[model samples]
Target: MTTLGLIGSGHIGSQLARAAVAHGYDVLVSNSRGPDSLSELILELGERATAGTTADAATADLVAVAIPLKDVQNIPADLLGGKIVIDTSNYYPRRDGTIAPLDAGEMTVSEFVQAHFADARLVKAFNHIQAPAITDDAQSAGTAERRALIVAGDDDDAKKIVSGFIDAIGFDVLDIGPLSASWRIEAGTPAFGPRRDREELEIDIAQATRSARH
Candidate 1:
């Protein structure tokens, strides 16, 4: 069984947990506030879910970083090494403060995260969809109208791993090139909010314009 580890229990993280459990994946969720703070969420997630430290969650088969951009520094470097990490963060200057490389358009949000978690296999995914849509719109495999999620990553094998999990969780994936092209589906772009199928998503990704890295 695939155990999905979540490093943030906010809207996106928690919703991702629900979708993971819906697909019968065991989940270990953690937040900066500590495991004790996540007890209620764990109870809601039932036996398959456990409240773990960030390091604990990092050890799972796959880990997703869904916290606010500013919190990226808190991610456990040593524990996340060798794990496939999903980068679900958007860099908001107002909330996260401005990053020089990002502001200069020289690097992307995924690149910023890559610099921090260099040892981990990073895949940029699950950042484009709205939190509520993740659960409300999930469809079983082969469903006719499955939604699509945009994915960008550096490693081919790593992207394939996350792609399989995304399929299992009810969304078809659009591999929109590498991590550098992550800005295509980032927040505020055409591919960011609306639920779209693979074809429509492909169009959106192609028509995407540069927006705030947030």
Candidate 2:
């Protein structure tokens, strides 16, 4: 059985943990507040779920990062090195403060995160959807109009792994090229929110345009 580690048990993280457990994956969830703070969540997740330190979670088969963008620096690099990390974070200047590259439209949020965990096989996902929609809107594979989630990463194998996980959890996967091109689904883009199938998502991606940094 695959172990899914979560590095932040906030809205998105908790939802992902639920989805993972529902699909028979053991989940290790952790947050900045410490394992004791996650006891309730673990109990709710049942026997398959365990609360652990961030480092402990990082050691799982796959790790999902659901923390605020500003705190990416706080993630332990040494432990996450060479791991497949699903980055479920978005950049909001108001909350994360202004980043030069992001403000200049030079690098997508995923690129910036990749730079921080240089050795991790990071795939940008779960960032474009709402927290509640992660499980609520999921549909089985082959279901007509099944919601599609976008994934962008520099590593082909890493993207494939994450895509499979998405499919298993009841959604379709849409690969939107590399991490550099992930701006198409960033917060301001048309593809960011809403539940769209593959075809509709493709159209939204095509219509995405970067507004002036200001």
Candidate 3:
């Protein structure tokens, strides 16, 4: 079983932790508030789940970064080294304040994350979709049809590792190439949060072929 680590205890982080626990993965959750503060959530998640400091969570086989985009730099560089770090953040100028380059379409959110967490195996995923939808694994298993999630990373092995986790959570995985091509999955793109069926998602991605902003 994968020992999952979460580096934020916000909505997405907390919900994803529950899903991971439900799927039988051992989870270590953390936040900026300190490990002791997460004791209540840790207790709710049961024995399979535990709370730890940010650095401790980052040391897992796979780490999910669910922090606000602006605060991502606070994550220690050494902590993320050589590990798969899942990015589940979005650029919300009002709440997170403006990121000039991101607002200008000069850099994708994932690219910014990679630049900050340079040593980590960064994968652009779980960003376009909403956390509520992500929590609903049953949405992926029903006959009514569910959408595929985009995953972009330079490393093939890391992408596969993340894809396996995606599959375990009941969603289809769409390989959108490397990190440089992540603009295709960023917010404001047509593909972002489109809960269409798998075939629809593929076609949507294929048809609107604009050059992704570097």
Candidates' C-alpha lDDT: 0.88, 0.92, 0.81
TM-score of each: 0.95, 0.97, 0.90
Off by over 4 Å in 3: 139-144, 207-214
Q: What's the TM for model 1?
A: 0.95
- What is the lDDT, from 0 to 100, of the residue 64 in candidate 3? 95
Q: Write the per-residue lDDT of candidate 3 for residues 71-163, one digit (tens) a residue.
A: 998777677888898988787787788787777667778888888888888888888777777766435455466667878898898999998
> Candidate 2, residues 111-134: lDDT per residue as tens digits?
999999999999999998999998
Runs of candidate 2 with Cα error greater than 4 angstroms are 212-214
- Per-residue error at 112 for model 3, in Å? 0.9
Give the total clashing residue pairs for model 2: 0
Q: Which consecutive 10 residues in model 1 have the weakest lDDT in total?
A: 205-214
State which candidate has the highest lDDT.
2
Clashing pairs in 2: none
State the lDDT of candidate 1 residue by residue for 1-214, as single tens digits.
Answer: 3899999999999999998998889999999999999999999999889999988898789899999999898765566888899999897889998788888778889988998988989999988888999888988878886899978999999999999989998899889988899988776788888889999999998898885443
